[model samples]
Target chain A: MTFLSGLTPYFIAVFCVLVVGFWIQLQREKKPEEPTGETVSTSKARRWVDQDLQDDTEIPAKNDEDDDDDDHGSELDLPHVPYAPPRYPVASMLERSQDFYSLMNQRRSVRFISPEPVPREVIDNVIRTAGTAPSGAHTEPWTFVVVSDPDTKHEIRTIVEDEEEVNYRQRMGNKWVKDLARIRTTWVKEYLDVAPYLLLIFKQTYGIASGGKRKTHYYNEISVSVSCGILLAALQNVGLVTVTSTPLNCGPRLRVLLQRPANEKLLMLLPVGYPSHDATVPDLKRKPVEDIMVHI
Target chain B: MTFLSGLTPYFIAVFCVLVVGFWIQLQREKKPEEPTGETVSTSKARRWVDQDLQDDTEIPAKNDEDDDDDDHGSELDLPHVPYAPPRYPVASMLERSQDFYSLMNQRRSVRFISPEPVPREVIDNVIRTAGTAPSGAHTEPWTFVVVSDPDTKHEIRTIVEDEEEVNYRQRMGNKWVKDLARIRTTWVKEYLDVAPYLLLIFKQTYGIASGGKRKTHYYNEISVSVSCGILLAALQNVGLVTVTSTPLNCGPRLRVLLQRPANEKLLMLLPVGYPSHDATVPDLKRKPVEDIMVHI
Candidate 1:
């Protein structure tokens, strides 16, 4: 009777975990209906406010109060403004030919340590460059969290290491461990701490409020990844080195550590700084263009 | 008895489709594993033979044969030298800065189009620019299928229109249909046939051989999307305009129309050409940098 009683608690614990896991899996897979009513209005209002302010002209304080009423009133009275098509400048064929090959060739992935801190202006410029990436429905569902604080860096390192340790020791099987063996990596998590700046890229899966309601986003993964690519290119163009790191099991840990809202999901952890003295990458080779490209 | 027999056929059809779909999903999720046994040596041998012939070395071919069998062959083996990375001397930051910024500032999406044929070289260069995207583990899992032949273009138009007709009629709910009502999209198949080129971006989820086993790729979706971003930028950087079109329930139809391999999945359909002379686009504006960036 006592043994049965003891096992009952354990069984109950197991059942609870299984139920929670299933619920999480279901939530991840569920495709929410398209958002309506206030959700659409709020996003529309935010977009309107952003557009009005992006121009150099400043609104007078008197106009600002009128603008607030206009925003709500216009929603009911007028048709919503259609999304503007992007307009790119035309470069002469000859001019484009001159530099096209060089810009294409100069792109390279850099990873190493340099102790110098990247200037705030340069970081700002790079972020500005990344903002040029095209997004789905122009929602631009991305957030670039640049961390330069020493204390926060240390905290991130500790959190990432804790999760990585679990991954390395228990979660990953032998095959995964073997594949990663060639690359020099450690649970020490020094890069998270030592790098002068850490850029945590978060993908807003959907828009959410303090209330549990959510707004739909289209092609969330594709949209966010495109933004990341542009960000990397922008950073590299400025002659900075960065390494993309994704601690697979550390997403939830990071959410808690960063006090992120539920709608945002951690996409990548980028460590940006100068390469260390004597920093060397693995002897790796990229596939040739012929191998990668197929003109059909 | 007749009813039961008819139901059996329907059940069999459903079962077959379910099985095929499950198999495809499984293949998509699978990751490539390291090859076992003598795969590495065989690849090395092939590379060595090609390198020696290219170098114009006078060493006897039999000497190479003997070298391959030697136990210490790896140590004494000729080094696999990579071709020098391409350089572009004329592409200076100063010269291209203005053009880059202008293009960046002016980039706009073009929806309405003219039936104008873009120059072949323009399309080629834009695709060439897309080829510069970096890949995961250097596995560039993308194939650009350019549709230019009249008959193929016509066939694509038919397929796309058929899908869009269904989307407009029944598939898309009232809300989605209402949201998209302002945009001038149609079930008419003219754009596919009229555009100079239809670039179909196919993501290779896995590699398959007639006799050999299939292998999976990592981050194929992200890699393909990044490449698409570059393609879009390249098109924008040049003077050509493009519209990324997704017809409802058309991916499978596209694969069938193109006679694509089972391992390849359609990522996007881009119609490339000059915009129609009278065409107009939605007046969309991008969010400001401050709204997008968060510094900690």
Candidate 2:
């Protein structure tokens, strides 16, 4: 009876602590108000282009500057990210373990690709594959935009080039340029148009509604990175070659061109398709396991 | 001749920049001889006992102090973190993508066990499975330390409990304690001894040698997290049930007990085995797909 009494306080203390923790978590869920820096009209005006160009010249000059906040137009009201636990048969774990080992060993990063156009179903299946990644508070703060239209691709290419020109010529200084020197990358912007599919990854830095306030995401960077990893693995698994292209200059330009909302920020541009028949990569080697692992 | 004349200057400029970048990168790789203000010895001594006790008691504590860098082992020489282009084939990509998706869907955070002993070969295969995670510069910065021996498991349990005790008693404030309420986690070291295998994940924060100077690793957090994800998936694929355990106080305690060399930091303690017959999880649901994905 005495031992039970002593343990009672500890149990009660634990229970009380847990209840309070749950309440605090619930309170943390309340969204913050919309940021009041730039007006809606000005923001939209900045991204709106005149949409005038010749067939051979599909580039949209970076000149649109509009601030319109009321245009929700088919804007995706994406819900919180999902965190579904897997359901596997316990009996087959050993066999599955062997299969996973072999599969992982065979896994590699693909740069060179065949020039064959990928089927739409294959792309859809890959996206579906990415849907399984776990996220913070189950808020899978990610968006995957697929672009296949030739005209849109040309427009994207043009805007991206305009941005890249600025980055390469002015924004990216000596250090940045030097770091990227070995990659043999150029702001040619041909891949944006040549690749059969352009998949744009957007990170939801903040969430906003038509009139509702904004919500803050916890561990946003970590959450997004994890999702990206899963997405990359999925794309690779399906036999599609992906080149992760970042629109360092073209985000705002493309936003106006694509009419993206204010809350969504661009993260990566993945051009997915067959690699050019003669595509070649730099000769690189991976660090040995001993250099990376420690057994303590 | 005209084309060659035009490209000559550009090539010269590129060559100059590459030489400078390599020099700078090599300079950055050198480690500082003097220690930072934080001393590892003091912090380790302080938490050593508390860690042992917390494991036996199974109390949930949050010791924020132990999270300090100095408490980890000796700092090692970190390699240059490189951003390289991926390489892989297109056809094999689709097959792997479907397999990963299926594997992910089958994953679960398991805590129950069946008391059945797992074979050494199975454990070896599972660890090998985790070795396949993609890493920055292909560094693969990870270590899997398996503990099945009765003595080692007991020692680990004691070390973990001591730290957890302090966390629940005084170190963890009411708010922090409350947040972890939903998950019924305790510091009981039983899982270490009871489970058939206890896999300790130690992340090489930097690189160190027997006598050579230490090296630095870039994006260490992101690198380790990806490795952990791959490890989790690998374990699941093999048919083993795992509980991803984070010891609030064991970081310093385990470093000392295991006599791990400087440079390695404990990341997670994963207990692996078959589920107990009546293992039950909290009736929690994942966030919706719409909430996680956004289109721009």
Taken over the whole model, the C-alpha lDDT of each candidate is 0.56, 0.53
On residues B209-231, what C-alpha lDDT tens digit does candidate 1 reach at each position? Answer: 23344433445666777777767
Chain A of model 2 scored by TM-score: 0.64
What is the per-residue lDDT of model 1 for residues A97-180, given as tens digits with 9 covering 90 to 100?
335534654554434556566666566666665666666545577777888988988888888888777555444433233334
- Candidate 2 per-residue lDDT over residues B27-125, each given as its tens digit: 644633212222234333232222101111112124322223231122122222222234445455556556666776655555565567877666776
Give lDDT tens digits, candidate 2, residues A1-296: 99999678556645665576566545645532222222233334223211110010011223211212222322212211223344355446566767656655554444444446777656765665555555433345666777888788889888878866655545533322333434445577677777888887666654443555444433333445445555665664554556655466466667666667765666567788765554544334444445433333
Q: What ranges in model 1 sit over 4 Å off?
A: A1-101, A177-189, A208-213, A274-279, B1-102, B182-189, B209-211
Candidate 2 chain B — worst ten consecutive residues by lDDT sum?
B51-60
